[model samples]
Target: MRQAVRSQFTAQRAPWALHRRPFSTSYTRSGYADTLRNLRIGSHTRVIFQGFTGKQATANARDSLAWGTKIVGGVTPGRSGEQHLGLPVLPTVRQAVEQLKPDATAIYVAAHQAAAAIEEAIEAEVPLVVAVAEHIPLHDMLRIHSILKTQSKSRLVGPNSPGIISAVGKCRIGFQPLPCFSPGRVAIIAKSGTLSYETVASTTRAGLGQSLCIGIGGDILPGTDFCEALAAVEHDPDTDAIALIGEIGGIAEMEAASWIREYRSRAVSPKPIVGLIAGIHEVPGRVMGHAGAFTALDEPDAKAKITALVNAGVTMVHHPSDIGEVLREKLQGGSSSRQGILSGLGFGSQRRQMSTVSRRHRTSAQRAVPQQKRHLYLSTAQSVGLLIETDRTIRSGSPAATANSQYLVGVGIDRSSRMPCIIAGHPLDVLSEGHLKRFPFDFQRGPVDIPAEQIASHLGLRNQQTAIDSLSRIIKSLVTIFYEKEAFLLISHLMETDKSLTVVSARFGFDDAAFRIAGRHQQLHEMRDAAAEDPSELEAEQSGIVYLKLAGDDATVGTLVNGAGLAMNTVDALARLGGRAANFLDTGGKATSETVKKSFEVILRDERVRVVFVNIFGGLTLGDMIARGIILAFEELSLTVPVVVRIRGTNEREGQQLIARSGLPLFAFDSFDEAAAKAIELSRR
Candidate 1:
């Protein structure tokens, strides 16, 4: 991978364009075209528009054509056989390909029809597809994504996005402003389309121009992820430094940080990355802006994302203006307060009036010791009695320990021989001898003062016993269970012991399973294993992977759209719907005639796919995509299994028109329940 020049400015004028040069092919495959000067966008590229007749589609198409896009044709079922802006229009993508033989497509359909449009594009064998619609249904997006994954050669950009622009050449395929952008040495990748413009504006302001500006979509499941884009940037020589703009959603930032660390540690030529993460407001369960923008876990929030990138040594900024300043500092090694001042300005009002009075006190809690650390010891004289008593405690909180001890001692024991003795428990014994060597105990602080003398006395003795037993339990049963399952041992001990023993045991088990379970349950309970009729049932089972088959109806498409979001929801819904999906497949709206054909081919290709549910919502996608797919499957692939489809939305009338025209026996439905029911029924059949 060649390193692109870092644009430099003299504060009085814009930087000059770096001379074009070829980059090693290694980086090209990683999609880091922005870092190389001579990175080429193949001229053989072909294009199809899903909603080619729409105003937005027409305007973008005209601009794209003028910008050197090789748009082959478009799909508008009802308007098929017509011409728009001098581009031929076909009823389906299959027909367009037959006419134009193009390799890429741009979908400018409505959100509702986004899934079908994408599916159609894929079927046509277009290597790349970009969707410019926003608010596409989550499920539909996933189905389209599944199709993309199956056909790895093809890539889908977004159901909501500004799209991609290759500075190496004039390949403007989406809705980003071209005037503010110029091909240079820097690669700008962002989550927000508008923010991408802001980033480019800042770069240009700093006399640094972009090599390529790619909006990976604000949605969670975009065609390209941060890591994918970064890999591309890393390989481009023309790119001196990369600027990344992320938002609150997913672990992509963290993942990128890890990858960057690995790459740097491996002595790879590291490109300095400037990171900015957006979205600080708390909006539970609602994606910000893009349908796929969502945080699955709390740690992936904006603050955490910034921290991760900062820790990874990337330049950080809060304001768009600071972007240029940081880039200049990194490239030129100059003092800059761009980030600090911008952040201070952005946070000024809130900081000025901020109050800590109402803020909740935060504290770090210690982790529980592993079960292997919880050692129990008793004098040999009282071993038998202690065993009986300890057996009771183990039975309650430590079933595994109790069971193991029982198995070791033989299942049956004579009660008369059982003599109780002093026993102690400590959950922290798992720490190494080195840790215990530095154990903190302020013995001079004189055992903690207690209001209750009885409780205090018992605690003191128990503490001593635990310390002694920690070393003494080298022989008697040394049991280790996960910290989480320690309750069983604690509960059994509490049930079988007196107040003094309980106090001593509790002290050793302080902050252990006993406390945790008690806190959650609000009751001291004994753990008991459910009895099985057959002992064979108790045999341990090895872990194995099981693949599931996921099918959807129109409603499912409406609910989940982004690939990741859709995959998550599909897996969750399948479990909820009393079945499981093997993998995710989303035939995007405006799926060309060929994409529809290929989708079935991919699904049937999966041996694990015992059944398939064809979920379609007629939104941006015409029923033609689904209808053509079914017809193609039967005609070319000879598919004979079960298939169910539910179509509704924009071009729905045309989609239904195709379905009626095809005369195929597709299980169709108007409602989600009906579709789900049909899918379930077909799977059973």
Candidate 2:
């Protein structure tokens, strides 16, 4: 057992870098997946580590090497003539380039210095660079992009990304968890790092593998987006289908969906695309974990993205676990098999044919059929490839063609009576004598405590919080059963809330399952809306801020920053100085003066906002424009919100002069720390 475990672990270890294929003579970029594959770093591509001595760099380097990544050298400023992990460490990227001429460079540097590291590699003319550092200022990225787009011949993958991996080529750049990947024909492109991993795992488990996986960073503006990735995959000869995982925020998913729609309309044989979008349950104006995951009032969210993709004829997966089964069913043009467990429980082979029997024949064979098992009406997505019919006549011809409308039935036993019952909404009298003789089973007969009796009992003994705590586990268990069986169900359960007996029922299909609590006649849509509204209660209350409204009112310090990183820092600075922020508003980069003024308006709208701090570091943006907006907002609102402004970068002097000369109570500062400290102090008064 020990030896077997060791062998498995060893097999799971990353493969060594593949031998370099001859450099492609043509660098002209193509529009399809082939283009991405053409320039992709493979076994032959030598990689250099920037920040090689750093802990993360060293550890990742080891994994890259173990996985057969051909890492040629390392680069660290002022660390020339050193050695790291038996590789030469040059003082600069230029030196490493001059010596090893590596094809790619992976950056592992602090957020403050990440841009400079990328600049160094670009200056050295490296062909490919994967930037793993995150939290760099927005202005720095603009500058880095300028360098990357012009003077450098390098292609930048990410500044805040997990990187890219190609299973078939045996090359991985970035920090992807590699074991989930298997060499197959499907290509996975995702915006979220963890979501991509989960999807890949699902695909691998379902016997469908991947050709490559790209994590396009969760930032609002990563170096690359879904459109470019999709274009690359379109031309890849090896990839048969594309699996896209997107989250809320940004127009990238919409862009990709639009492109797919056009591609499908034009192409003779368009490849199948299956998509799973996260943040379907997200609230507008609230940011999830990703820095780029903020949904504005008018911008597209998960629902819109899903609708667009589905309209474009993409097979939509409601859950990550369903990716593999969906892909196989869609690509193979058939049904998926999900009856292993049921069959093991002695439910004979799914393909068994019963002789032609009338209603009388079924009655006569009632004793032959097991009385301990129940009948279940199951309907599954066409992509899941499961069609198990029990106690029913089989029709000839393709079953999958009518999969959208056909319902399959499976048999199971009632836990208490040990008698057979059907999950379908029907009367027990319609079934054979196998039923344990349970009542009406009609929709009118409400409040049956069969499927959810344990949940109701458990809730009885628990407080609201405790009951809510177990809700996730129960939901997960329920969802898992559906996924495992590749089916959807409309079922009812009993519950007691507010000491009133309520028959709770839900239609479970897709990710957005609807549920209802019966007051009398059971209004489902209202109950579903009520249930859905609870998740984003804070969002439903406020419409402008990116997160829940911070506590503090009319005299508290509020931060108006241009980037997520700066906003987070300002919040932390206020906390450290014994002040609580009233709200956080990030006016994204490249904002016009009008946009900046609009941002100020949002901050000023907060009733609790007292001392507003505006911090702007304009790299691509003009500080003067931002200053103009602030002055305009102050004049228009005729407000008494004492404001502090700190402007840096391009046109900083002019912006400061405009704010300082304004005959208003606006204060200007030279630095962030000073501005934050003064804002916190002023808020107290």
Candidate 3:
């Protein structure tokens, strides 16, 4: 494969574009993994544990050792002559350095003492130090960062982080749960810890293994930001692709976007970036667990950050589950066509690849199908519509066959409304500027009630019915076919008033829309496993609900929740409290008792799950209804593993009373943190 890619790179040499050569195809697939392994902390580097005698440090150090990290020794304030897990302990970092010559230090000291420990490591000249303590005074962190910026040689990762892991290297530092990560070529750099875990697990399940994963910390002042880590990944030999996980917080994601934009503007071959920002659905000013998670009105937030990155040429994934598949598409040569086009133009490398695969109507038969070209759009907005550009061409299956034609498709969407339409100019240009203000219609504000005559007149159409009739014909044949059972399918055909342009439009369910657009038949086949039992079982699988079954050998904890953000929070807490999540189910709004029972029954079908964690923030779905559903499901499944439940919001009192009378060994709590901690404790048992 390497040789083939090298040959392709050599053969593509347009003499005039020599200086604009993009990367050889092998660079993204294999060369990156090699580079990253060498640039970042290698598996062979020696590691030392600071505050090694503490309980948290001891547990993490043992796990790191079990994972094959090279732990040379340990440092404790007063346990100089003692040992931990058969490793020698020294009183201070200076003495440990003198004796062990360790390459890096993992600090597990208390919050107040974290600053001094970090300063000690820096003064001792350790190459890297990962501080896992939280609650360090703000001033102390400012001082520590200052030392890192000007006075120290050490690179600090976090004062409140889960640390870092090199999957291929088999090295684990900090407290990240090792089972969730797998060895591969992609690397992740995230500000939030649990979210990073979710991404790694997703990547592993998708069969796209990770090279290195870093929880860079969720602090107001992380020692490192996306740019620094990205630069490192860019140079690392072990990483082939990158996933940047951001949240609704500080300007770290924005800064990373700016850096990537600038990097692409100058570099010959830029790495493919999968950018994801959590909290798109979160309310403003509401902090979501992490200390650095508060968003300002003027800050980029999830929407602005996603748009900026998308505009700057990053592949944006709205959910964590999409990271692996998207990365796989780019790595397995799907992105080569765009690179070929860009390299030919002396533009270095393209920032984003244009979709080229045509749609597959279905895959129930075995036969050759003609390829169809498509334009793809990824949005962070809750809903979207589009204005598209299209044309038709004619072809015959055989020389003796009569002439026949198929439509040539080019599509784009208004950034604001996400409406589908046929416009007069380039699709990308139209999308970048959103809808045409002069057209005088907002597809997003409400129903598209503009009379057919008015729309026809605006676009200079001679007759509204003629265009509608033509559009209806196209819709009857192609647009009405449903991809998913619950899909709200709509197809539109449009013609220019001057009779020069024609286009078709469709609105797709957010899930799997990309795959439908890209002609990934094999992936579509894999999605059939998760179909809903029936439409009325809305609570078990609401239209708004999204269930992501993790890819792993075994399942442990299954999350049942009312909101996506809450699901994520439960996962994060599980990781922090030393738990592993096997699957996630988001019930969206208003789930009934029947929905709850059916959902639990579905979860129990997974043999790996030892426990179920339910967190409900009742709104339209009352707490009492949730409690009743749990009782019903508990009786139906005859569940053996612990069922931990957390409930709040409407009918909180009645809900508690009903759960108390269930006579099951079920545990219930009103706090997310307490419930998560208990769930993890039970899962470990």
Q: Pick the candidate with the highest TM-score.
A: 3
Runs of candidate 3 with Cα error greater than 4 angstroms are 1-39, 335-685
Report the Cα lDDT for candidate 1. Answer: 0.48
Q: lDDT value for candidate 3?
A: 0.57
lDDT by residue for model 3 over 181-256, one digit each (tens)? 7888888998766557657866887798899887777665676667778887876677888998877655567667
- List per-prediction Cα lDDT, in the order shown: 0.48, 0.56, 0.57
Ranking by TM-score: 3, 2, 1
Off by over 4 Å in 2: 1-39, 335-685
Error of 2 at 525 (Å): 44
Q: Once superposed on the true structure, which residue ranges of model 1 sit more than 4 Å away at CA?
A: 1-44, 78-81, 281-286, 333-335, 340-685
lDDT of 1 at 284: 36
Q: Residue 458 of candidate 1: its Cα lDDT?
A: 29
Which of the two candidates, 1 or 3, achieves a greater TM-score against the reference?
A: 3
Measured with C-alpha atoms, the lDDT of residue 280 in candidate 1 is: 44
Q: What is the per-residue lDDT of model 1 for residues 173-196, given as tens digits with 9 covering 90 to 100?
A: 787755556666678877766556
- What is the full ranking by lDDT, best candidate first? 3, 2, 1
